[model samples]
Target: MYQYTPFDRQFVHARAAQFRDQLERNLAGTLGDDEFRALRLQNGWYIQRHAPMLRVAVPYGELNSAQLRAMADIARKHDRGYTHFTTRQNVQYNWIPLPQAADVMDKLAAVDMHGIQTSGNCIRNITSDALAGVAADEAIDPRPYCEIMRQWSTLHPEFAHLPRKFKIAVSGATEDRAATGWHDIGLVLRKNEAGEIGFQVRVGGGMGRTPIIGSVISEFVPWQQILVFIEAVVRVYNRYGRRDNAYKARIKILVKAEGQKFFDAVAVEFKNILERDLDGSAHLITQAEFDRVNACFVRPAGVVAQPEVAAAADLPLAYRRWLERNVHAHQVAGYRAVTLSVKRAGQAPGDVTDAQMDQAADLADVYSCGELRVTHDQNLLLPWVKAADLPALYEAAKAAGYATPNIGLLTDMIACPGGDFCALANARSIPVAAEITERFDDLDEVFDLGDIDLHISGCINSCGHHHSGHIGVLGVDKDGTEWYQLTLAGSDGSNHAPTAVTGKVIGPSFAASEVVDAIEAILDVYRAERTAGEKFIDAVKRLGLEPFKAAANARRTATARHSDTAEA
Candidate 1:
């Protein structure tokens, strides 16, 4: 787990004080509403529909037991007891009072945490693979690099007010677990023929109204020049990227307008300019600095071998099923990665109460080194548990309602905060999510479905990662009513390709429960007709949408035949 340095702790404390003073002035009528609005955003406070929302940076999704416990306390004390984990890997408290926002920051600073750079037109928290350093395939840990980027980007004076918010993702492997292709700048640690590690850099890929996969602007960025190259790219974007139209502001638009060849040439020119200014403006990265960052993430000593986990071999058939489904690879020989599922049957997806958060921290304390990682899919991950204690860990997770074992199954869904809470949504996404999970009660049925990703977004911005889901559902508002638009074959996987629109609006704003039934109707047809070894997405691609859409819209049979399973 990461411990805050004295300087880190003090920095947050100072920021909180700064925000507190600003708030006092604003409320006392010394500061205008517009002035205070900008200042409050600088401190991660947002005025949403119902109340102020506070986004707390988790710092590459790594935190300690103490930090999480503090989060639970802060939520219960200053805001709602429920916190929402976003796809960006930060937690948002939706019902914070504006007057108490700075106080919330003060509470966070006490635990060496802050909400800085979590919003506004600034660099957001740098993200990496959630399962970094512990996947079955080996790569250098990406967290240390992500942390370095976080430090460099935070409050960066030069790029503080860019044309738009910029996002960067780093991956440590061939597989794009961090959505590297959909970020302003993406780095893949790579080894050259001489075994020298550097970075394979891509720029200009991002998502919004216009989604694009980044192109490789540099095949090989020397190890020492990583940060310098990134700076050059951002500099170019800051100067030339769109500021006229919000939709056109992302670097992707710049790349699209410039053409790939032109974009690559300009980037190369920028890289050359930086190299010439190495001693002046460019401080090339060094092995020592990398080592200094890497030191922060070193694993704890004496990772105990859990020989007693052999008891798992003698467990009931269902326990064995859970052990196989939820457990993942660990870099350490004796340890295993544990993903605590929040997707219990018939529950809202990606939600955790203050109590649940506390329990998660407690689980981390006893089994691992009081550490946790939040995956993009909204599950808590204990990354360094010993294998021999699997049975005990499993039981503990079950007792605490954290053991659903449906990490990537059909029930594992990504849904946005829709009409229930979000001001922007026209339809509710949570109940639809709950409906789908309950409908797929049989694990064997879902396992056979194989690697289905269902992502729902209440609107076009695709906050739920609908562009990445194998089955993408978007809520559209037509004349003050709700409607759903479905897309098939989309993915956020290693070689993900965006889904093609199925083009069948099954219902002109179907009722919440009816949508789930529509999806079930479609799945039934897939199961009945799919070729052996074909996944749902694969079967859809192999056969196309006419059949699936028809089955879902089979209204005559919908009532008696599981109507709630219709297109959730």
Candidate 2:
């Protein structure tokens, strides 16, 4: 984790104080609601459906045990007894009051955290792989680069307010767990023919009403010039991006409208910035600075590998199941990364109780390296757990309600805080997610179903990244009733896939009550149609939507016939 320096501390505290003053004035009638809207939004305070929601940034999804404990404290003291982890690796308190917003900011600043740049139409949090440094297939640790961008992007004067909210993601591994294809700017680190490491820059990729995979503008950019290139991309969007309509203001719209011309313009702008040194800050990012940032993330030590214990045949079936689902391979031989599943049965997909957060911090201290990484899938990662201690860790996790043994299964769905919290949402996402989890609670059945990425979003803002799911469900409002539109064969980031594809709509939308049935029908079709050893997404791609649609309609017809027969 990046430690906050004195200057960083001062900057955050000062910002918190400034916001406190702004809030006080607004309460005192010096500032109106309209006047304070932008200020509140930039600070991550949203006037949501029922109350104010505060989104606290977890930079690159990295936080130490102390910070986790602080978050728990905030959750316990202020809002409800739980907090919601977002798809972008941030945490939100949905029940916060307007008067206590500044107080929450002060608490976050106390732990070297803040809500700055978390919302509004500016560059949001720079996210990367949850297992960035620990992943076995990593080309390089992407955290250093992510941190550099985090420092550069936060409250950037040149891009304080873009036409729309922008996101950037970086991937260090062959497996793109960071969902690089769906970001405004996606950087994949790779070595050139000469073995010099650089970035493959993809721009204008985003998910919303108009979802599109980004275009590769630059094949390879040297490490030192990354900031300059990013600036150039944002500058082009700022200059030409649509501002007349909020829906058309995103960089993806500009990219789609202009085609290759946008890429060409970015190249020209990048060259101009590089040649003229438009910002003197670009020169400050030399190898020494990179090294300095990299040095902060030291590899964990004192790991003792107990091969016998790890390989024990006498291990409990529960522990083995958890090992298979929750544990992941690590870059270091003796260590493993463990994902704590927050998508347990009968709960909101990403909701975690304050007590659970405290317990997680304690477990991190005991088994992990006293740090945790928040996954894009709305889970937490203990990135440096010894393989030998996994059994004990699993036991502890189970007791703390962290061990669900459903990491990548159908039950482990990605969802957004929808109509329950957001004013923009058309339907409630929590109930939908809970119903799905309850319907597919059997671990054996989920395992048998195999590697299905199910995602649900309340609306078309795509906050849940539904377009990336193998089975995507988007809630819609039609004639005052909640309905769900289904999409199939979508994927996020993957080196295995031919290309990352946005899910296509299957057919008509289903009523809220029929969603689970529709999902089950789709799964039944998959089980019957899939070839041996085929993953769910691959099967969907191979077989297409026709089979699934037929099965879904069949389920509906069967249910209607059964109802008629019972009535008779």
Candidate 3:
């Protein structure tokens, strides 16, 4: 994690005090609600349908045990007993009062956390692969670059406010864990034929009302030129990105309006401006700076696994499953990336209690090199756990409600904190995620479902990444009643698939627990008909949505089946 420099420290502290003054004035009636709304939003406070939601930035989703403990303290002291993890790797407290908002900022600053750029149209959190340094497939640690952008983008004068919110993601591995394809600017670090690490810049990719996979504008942006190139991209968006209608105001719209050929020409012209005028060339991260950032994430030592833990890892069945799913190799030898599964069958997808937070912190102290990462998939990651200690670590995790043993299976779901907490949500996503978990309690059955990525969003912000799931469920309202819309063969990363709306389930709004069974039922049909060794999405892609859709819609009551709620 990047420690705050004196400048950084003063920046957040001063911002906190400024917000405090703004909040005081608003309370004193010197500032109106509209005035305070912008101020609070820029400071990352949102007036939700119920309470003021506080979004705390967990940059690149990297947090030390101490920071994790601090968040647990905040959750326990100020708000609810738990916190909601978001898609961009942020944590939110849904019930933060406006008056206490500044106070909360003070508390966060004490622990080196803040909400400074968490909201607003400014370049939001710069996310990277949660498995960055530890992933076996990575060519470089993307966090250093993420931090570089974080420092450059936070409260950037050029991008303080945009036509719409802009997001950027970076990936360091062959696997696109960071969802590079769906960001305003996606940077992938790659080694050129000359073995020099550079970036493959993807632009115009985003998910919203208009979803498109970003096209690569530059195949080889030399390391020294990354910042300049990035500025070029942002500047072009700023100059030409739509501002006419808020709904169609994202960069994706601009990209669509301007074809890739035009975007390329414009980006080229913009890059020349960055090279000639802006001297970001000097600020490019040097080797020494990279080493400094890398030094703090030192590999840990020591591991003694329980006999049964070793046995489990050695089991031909269990070991192979664990290796394929649980173990991701690290850049450091003798260490492995361990994804701690909190997304269990029958559990809320990303909900963690404060006690569980402490337990995770403890695990990080023991086996994980004193670090914890919140993955975009709504799970916690102990990035560098030793292979030998994985069994014992797994056991500790099992006891602490951290071990679920389902990573890519049916239960490993990503859902947004929906209507329950968010004013933008059309329905409740937590209960929907929870219901599905409850119905699919059998680990064996979940595995049997085999590599299905099911995502649900209460509404279309796509926070749950429902837009990118192998199977996505979107909730929509028909009249006053809430109904769910289904999308199939959609994927977030890896040969990315655009979200597909399969069919509308006709029936009374199913209980949250029942949705899982409904999904299981849909998968059962796929398994029965799928060809050998086929993953869920491949099968769905091989065979269209007809059969699965038939079975899924069958559970709909006769009245619900024919109702006008069906959107497709």
User: Can you give the TM-score per candidate against the true fold?
Assistant: 0.92, 0.97, 0.90
TM for candidate 1 is: 0.92
**Clash tally, candidates in order:** 17, 0, 6
Worst lDDT 10-window in candidate 1: 496-505
Query: Of the candidates numbered 1 and 2, which has the greater TM-score value?
Result: 2
Residue 544 of model 3 has an lDDT of 76
| True-structure Cα RMSD, model 1 | 3.5
lDDT string, candidate 3, 193-236, tens digits: 88998999888887666667787788888876687777776777
254: Cα error in model 2, Å:
0.5
Q: lDDT-based ranking, best first?
A: 2, 1, 3
Per-model lDDT: 0.77, 0.88, 0.77
**Residue 425 lDDT in candidate 3:** 82
Question: What is the alpha-carbon lDDT for the whole of candidate 1?
Answer: 0.77
Error of 2 at 157 (Å): 0.8
Give candidate 3 misplaced runs (Cα > 4 Å): 274-324, 344-347, 495-518, 557-568
- State the lDDT of candidate 1 residue by residue for 335-376, as single tens digits: 898988977764567778899889999999998778888778
lDDT of 2: 0.88
Clashes of 3: 6
